[model samples]
Target: MGKATGFMEIEREETIERDPNERIKDWKEYSTPFSDDMMKRQGARCMDCGTPFCHIGMEIDGATSGCPVYNLIPEWNDLVYKEQWKEALDRLLKTNNFPEFTGRVCPAPCEGSCTVAISEPAVAIKNIEQAIIDKGFEEGWITPRIPQIRTGKKIAIIGSGPAGLAAADQLNQAGHTVTVYEKADRAGGLLTYGIPNMKLDKDVVARRVKLLEDEGVNFIVNTEIGKDVTGDELKNSNDAVILCTGAQKHRNLPIEGREAKGIHYAMDYLTISTKNLLDKKINNEGLDAAGKDVIVIGGGDTGADCIATALRQGAKSITQFGKHPQLPVKRGSENMWPAYPQVFSLEYAHKEAKAKFGEDVRQYSIQTKKFVMDENGELESLHTIEMKKTRDENGIFVFEEIPGTEKVWPAQLVFIAIGFEGAEDAIIKEFSVSATSKKIDAEYGDFRTNVDGVFAAGDSRRGQSLIVWAINEGREVAHQVDGYLMGESALPSVVNA
Candidate 1:
């Protein structure tokens, strides 16, 4: 370890962020750069544990114990402390295909599993990772690596999200002719539209997409499989196809007055706002929340993104609803070290709401009873009831409405960010693939669909999950595809590692 007593000598320091009030004025990224010295100090906080659970990603009680991408966290932290940033970048990229994307958007499960976190704060692995990749870009170290020889085997990836991109990157590096098809007008499916620009700037996505394009991966935008092109056509055109179409089907709140005009899906709202922002439009063309009382349903990252987006759009007031009770501020014993903890913490949007409105703007353990509509079928307010979880005769927990807790709140705009159910069924049907529920039926390890020579990965194969897991699945699927094509594969597997 660099400086054997470095962990004892240095206190953990987080990356500085732009002022909330100032940052809320624009959609640009709010994170400011850290000095090289500050970064080294933060890197020094890594104890570099003997076990190093930070890189030993495994499941514990159905939750991710560490980073899904299996990033070489300690190795890079030591490199950063030694001021070997270029070497740090190399280690960071060994397992992760796109550190840039994960560095910005990942929830940092690695920190939760850090051995140092058993006592003090976890090492700032995410920030240190971001620093390494950012330096690599500034030094012009990141560039396309074109393959020397072509395998002459053509492959089709059906989505342009993290999983699809990672798979394409691996397959292309192995000298396969890879082409990605994105139904959206642009590539980088969720990265381009699902996430807010403040969290992950679209330019960053475009930059990586460009790099992949230059690396001999072809991306076809606005061309969807099963619609623009048929499954038979894809089978005829390519030697094999990997479906990475993400789980984008938004969950709905079917309640009274559901037909109200102001009710909108969170993805639709976020996507439109981003599209307008990219187009340089002064107005979001009715998707803007200016001078509106916005109520976001669901207390998740998507809800947080909606609140932040609304704040940028000048929403007069915002409130988010959570069906579950608030978690304890500290981790409970049941969720001990190395397990992804469920604890209460303020997210960026919550902090922004507190700064702007003088309140946290979140209500826990509440259920939306119905949407109240005014004249002309416009959403005027929301009716809600407090809920308490209780066991039924079957000993199964279910939400029970607490009597005398019914209330109404002014909500001209409502966003349902309750998460996704699965991928679009139309796309699933296009390949005549077997499906379990809304998700494509693909083996977790193999990522192969029931249809021969067809595969699935990412949110479409697994349910909706983190960007890191999607990237991991993509990399894994690419290896399997290579094995199927070449009869012997050299691509690495995160699962095997």
Candidate 2:
């Protein structure tokens, strides 16, 4: 809103990414930081609309629209445009606890709902967000703002993922002692391992963790509440317990030869690769994909990540399989500007794959039937069948196999990249909360479980979703927990960072 005609005068400028051929050579972030001028120009593209639905963190007619954390997108953009970076960051942090992480990795539903996008190109909201944070770090404005007073209340957060980190930040800022428990050797949950390094560098995650630790927040590494610390001990020690464990149990494909040694879950493959990179050098890890034909199942971001990672590892060949038909070349009427247009898109990984190979490595309406393996228990090929939609047993929806569509494709390794089911059952069981098929059933307003003082947030409550949603869940849950502990609380549930 700095200039009345800003959106009309300035065009959106996206952050430049490193050349694919060169970036995949090592375990590091591929996207480059925008220059000061470039970022300022991008910020200038914000219309900062009257409604500003860009940061409207709420639902619309039962459809998920607007930002999840309700980030003050236009305010921060104007601040950046005016070169008031410190103020911009303060505005950014008002709703979002970690713009540094989500700015880089989130799908940016805010941009999707931008009013400018209805007619003109959407503002470079995500790029501006990342730039503000990057600048904060450079200028030392990203220091921990620890609370000045203590509330004498203690909170325990399980799972050191984005959700857990966000919850800890909120609860601690409420002047309550907070401790985050992580089962992994390192602190950041999937941020450390589930995602490939090329997309998000581990160093950024490490820096954030260090900052959180210095903020007087306690971190217990390699310790799980259910396994290491008993639930009773945690409940007795802390006034309230919040579960932020993400939905990580992978959705499996039911097919023949599913137990083949060379066939594995995409998370397992990425976890080992990331762990090796963190522990030792990535090059030294034995997960080399050189000279192997790899087949990745599913067509989500994770599947595309596997394709990119394999290509970077010098895989001989790579192919991806998807069940749904390909989207249209242009946006449909229902998917006009904003509303997260469901049109054909080229992500970083897919672009890399197309550049390395002759074409995009994706096949629509294709499904894996079985894993074909060699006699030595090694995978060697894939038996798949073409599928089409048809009515089911209950007259709902089902996938029907096409006759004479069976085929065998050569593959040395296979990765199942389907999405997750829910949070791990161990801790969920230990809490002994009333549950649903996917997540725990807690009172909506209070976020309290059936067991008193125990709460569920993030993916554990809402199911697997964007990192931004997890942050909102954490922030809101902290407010409820704080209010429950004290007569009242000042913690903000101000959604949309």
Candidate 3:
């Protein structure tokens, strides 16, 4: 939908990042914005393939294949290429409520499924998207659109993360009275605290929250649903209740010495670090990795964020352990086109750590055996063993430790970034919502629970997933809730798209 032959003429160029050595001194956004001309050039590279899979929004081989929100990517790309900035912004906002958040933090599965990616670098869709929204805000084009009429329906959404915020935005726009509840001091759940500021600035999240507030969405912070307000009370007062509490039950390593004093969960560490930064505390609060040998267990984005956080805190040394083998440099046979590529690439955190430490800190194909503690019960070091991946008799993949490959690494501090399990049990039991061991019992499209007038969405319903998927569910649930309340719904659903 962009230039007819632009894909053959233009090359892909990503947004430039700040110098790692200098950026490690303070907490600030790492990536710099692209020029207007560069953004247009990048947008022009979108091939007008008859079947555009970039917005397919489905899973393939257990990996996300495209934009889960079903963004009008080709339309926006064409608009951007033609310098139709306002139209591009309209198309972007049509599906995504918060492009600023997704633009910065989302892994961008759309790019992986781009048709151009089959033979060449994919179109710079993410950069063009961020540019469009950022420009829209800069030009004062984005303003709160207060609903003209109220449906007299009250909806209470638990959790202030991406999913909750998206649902709130949709419901509020549909003329429903929406109140978002956050247990933390702020409104944005994962966006405000779980994620580090350097990756997504708190001001950015605050801006969206302020917009939502201006648009008639009420936010009640520092209020626990089951404790501060009972589930029965909430359900009786509100016309409907949507649980977007997210999957916050973190997974833990149960090895020996796991209860060491210095060991902490990655979410706790990140939340405290962000709180301290926001509070402007003179002395470091919570777990500080400064001048200490830090070891992070587990892999993925959380582990990388731990490395970056420790680097900023002036850690003496850092190491990360992952049980899985390193991904291939290019897409393997099993991970083909249109599916998210499983390949080796350095993220922002990895680049920063490598620039500072003169090497990558990730140690793959390794399993932690036990955490060694000092006499005071503080973390001292950890023992690990190299593991080899093999197929068992039933064709199940397993990691077998190699004999004589045991080693010890000094670690004064340890952070477990092993990911989350599911929604906390307390919330489920308090609401009497049916749930399995992992997620809330709710269908994908319907999003309705066994309880009348109650619904569930996002991670709490689907288990741990991407921010885009959460937003998709949030939008979809809003549609279902609107239909339940009004007997019909005009809201758009990405699932139907």
Candidate 4:
């Protein structure tokens, strides 16, 4: 598709990122693009394998490999290699409803399953995808095209997260009236508020939102369905309601001394920081992050983001701790291609942390037994001990503290990123909807909730998961809703169930 020996001749050229020290000076996005020529060569590195496992999106032999959203990887790579920017965008957008978001945030399991990644490094699929979209934006190819005819049905989406947005996009295209309700002040729930500005700019979210608005989707901000409006009111207002509220209840460490000022939930920290940044930029709100020792617990993406954010805030020092031991640089056999390798991986946040703090991550297996306190009920430090992995009574693996390995670390500020438990129960309870475990009670295959005319998708229904899965669930739920209202649907079934 590209230069005949491009794969062998030109090595993989990764996406360009700003230096950590330089990026920490601003809250804007830290990513830069490789030159057009570099992206083409990287695309050319896509091998013409007999079986392109990367795009299959299957659970084969108890080991998964492939794009979860079933992106047309090979076709788009070929188009990129051939320098067909417009065509590449078309093909990429066919499967992935939000390339800009995924290109920036998705881990790109497709690249891990790449035939070349077994020996050589994988082609930069994600970078190429981003480059294609950026060009689409630059060339003015991306625009809102409202449907010609209306189906005369209205859809109310409870959350404006990826899943809700995806469902609204598809349903709107099928000529349905889509209204997205966000509890936050903006259209994007997590994207605009929860995610730090350094990773994804709020303006970028605004841009997409504007396009959706132009495409005839109405967004209601700062409204909770059960509080501001009843679930029945939502049902009466719209032909269908799709729940996209993400799983947001922060998981607790449940140790003694949890009540302290400096011990903050990760989401709370991110939301406050983002709101401060936006208010300062637009409304002149005051916020600061200078000269404090920051300790982030839980070595997930959110933790990495907190580390990067603390560095940018001019922290005196930054340390990240994980409950588990360190991971290998590469995937082990049990964690092979297609399935997300449980092995270690690094993102821009880590690189930024390393650049600013001299250590990429100060991870620890033994962590806080309890939050130590100074005078007046303020957090000062943390007590800890060494931990080991052992089989529990059920023979399932568990982490436990060992005797005589106690230690303590200075923690001026602590951010916990232990992930979510499930969807918040308040709205669900007030709405009189039936929720069990993670998801709402609906038909066996349908997305309908026990409360008639209400449907749920994404983290609200599927629990905490990847953005790709949220988008897929949203698309599928939208189709089900469409059929329920109009007795038929033109929307594609993005998910089998």
Number of the predicted model whose lDDT against the real structure is largest: 3
Off by over 4 Å in 4: 1-6, 58-64, 281-288, 391-395, 442-445
Residue-level lDDT of model 2, residues 205-227, one tens digit each, is: 99999998888789999897777
Residue pairs of candidate 4 with colliding backbone atoms: 64-338, 64-339, 65-338
- Give the Cα error of residue 231 in candidate 4, in Å: 1.1
Sliding window of 10 residues with minimal summed lDDT for model 4: 281-290
* Model 1 lDDT at residue 326: 91
Question: In the order shown, what is each candidate's alpha-carbon RMSD?
Answer: 1.3, 2.4, 1.0, 2.4
User: For candidate 3, what is the total of clashing residue pairs?
Assistant: 0
Give the C-alpha lDDT of model 1: 0.90
lDDT of 1 by residue, 328-406 (tens): 9889987998998789998888989899999899999999999989888999999999999878999877998999999
Candidates' lDDT values, in order? Answer: 0.90, 0.82, 0.93, 0.80
Residue 7, candidate 3: how far off, in angstroms? 1.2
Q: Which ten residues in a row have the lowest lDDT in candidate 2?
A: 56-65
Q: Candidates 3 and 4: which is better by lDDT?
A: 3
Model 4 clash count equals: 3
Candidate 3 deviant stretches above 4 angstroms: 282-286
List where candidate 2 sits over 4 angstroms from the true fold. Answer: 59-63, 281-287, 336-338, 389-398, 495-497
TM-score of each: 0.98, 0.94, 0.99, 0.94
Q: What tens digits encode model 3's per-residue C-alpha lDDT throughout 360-446?
A: 899999999999899989889999999999999999998899999999999989999988999999889989999997699999999
